[model samples]
Target: MTTPKTNRKSGFPAVHLLEEIAQLLAEGPRTSNELVAITGYTKVTCCTRLKQLEASGQAYRVVAQASVTWYAGRKPAADTAAIIPRQPTVRDYPVIGRRDMLVQAFFGAPRECRA
Candidate 1:
């Protein structure tokens, strides 16, 4: 049987594309079309790079709508079956103690809120 074509490209192609795409995602989630505009790549090339990033676990996607997928960089997974983000919760805001309490006590009340 003939071998299927792998998406790999030689000469740091994935590295260059990965960094660019990661920067774009760091700014905000972007669709493949948006990436094409920003990276000056064709739809096929952009899609290819996106797939590579997802497979490598350096990025993740969210279905923003019926037909659109927004992609963003993720902290790379140690082992890549899947990566689940740690959801924010009330527990994350547990009260602080010690020096903060002393400062607050000395202040005798919080300062006025800024505009």
Candidate 2:
């Protein structure tokens, strides 16, 4: 009914997101920050895409630490369905979830641990 969507600004082929994510994980598992550092996408965007790759069976989570997680991916099926993110990852909260990522990343020790 409608054409497939790509990223908002870069206008790069959208599947490139899926494929690139998979290729990176081919080597081994990596956290969202690792993927963000390598890909230069915001942590938000990188994380959102990784989840998509996972949903499509092209990627999977490997581990977690603090508020971040590691993931591994594989080349996607030719017939795999693709769905664009609900919103561009440029927003702030979902980078790692609004619950406590800021505290976990910045504060490190929990309030209980600090006092």
Candidates' RMSD to native? 16.7, 20.5
TM-score list, all predictions: 0.47, 0.46
The all-Cα superposition gives candidate 2 an RMSD in Å to the true structure of 20.5
List candidate 2 segments past 4 Å from native: 1-15, 63-67, 73-115
lDDT (10s digit) by residue, model 1, range 7-114: 333323434776778778778877888887767656887788788888876677766566556556564354463655676665565544434678778876565557
What is the C-alpha RMSD, rounded to one decimal, of candidate 1?
A: 16.7
lDDT tens digits by residue: candidate 2, 37-68: 77766778788888887777677664445755
Q: After superposition, how far is residue 66 of candidate 1 from its true place, in Å?
A: 3.7
Which pairs of residues collide in candidate 1?
none
TM-score for model 1? 0.47
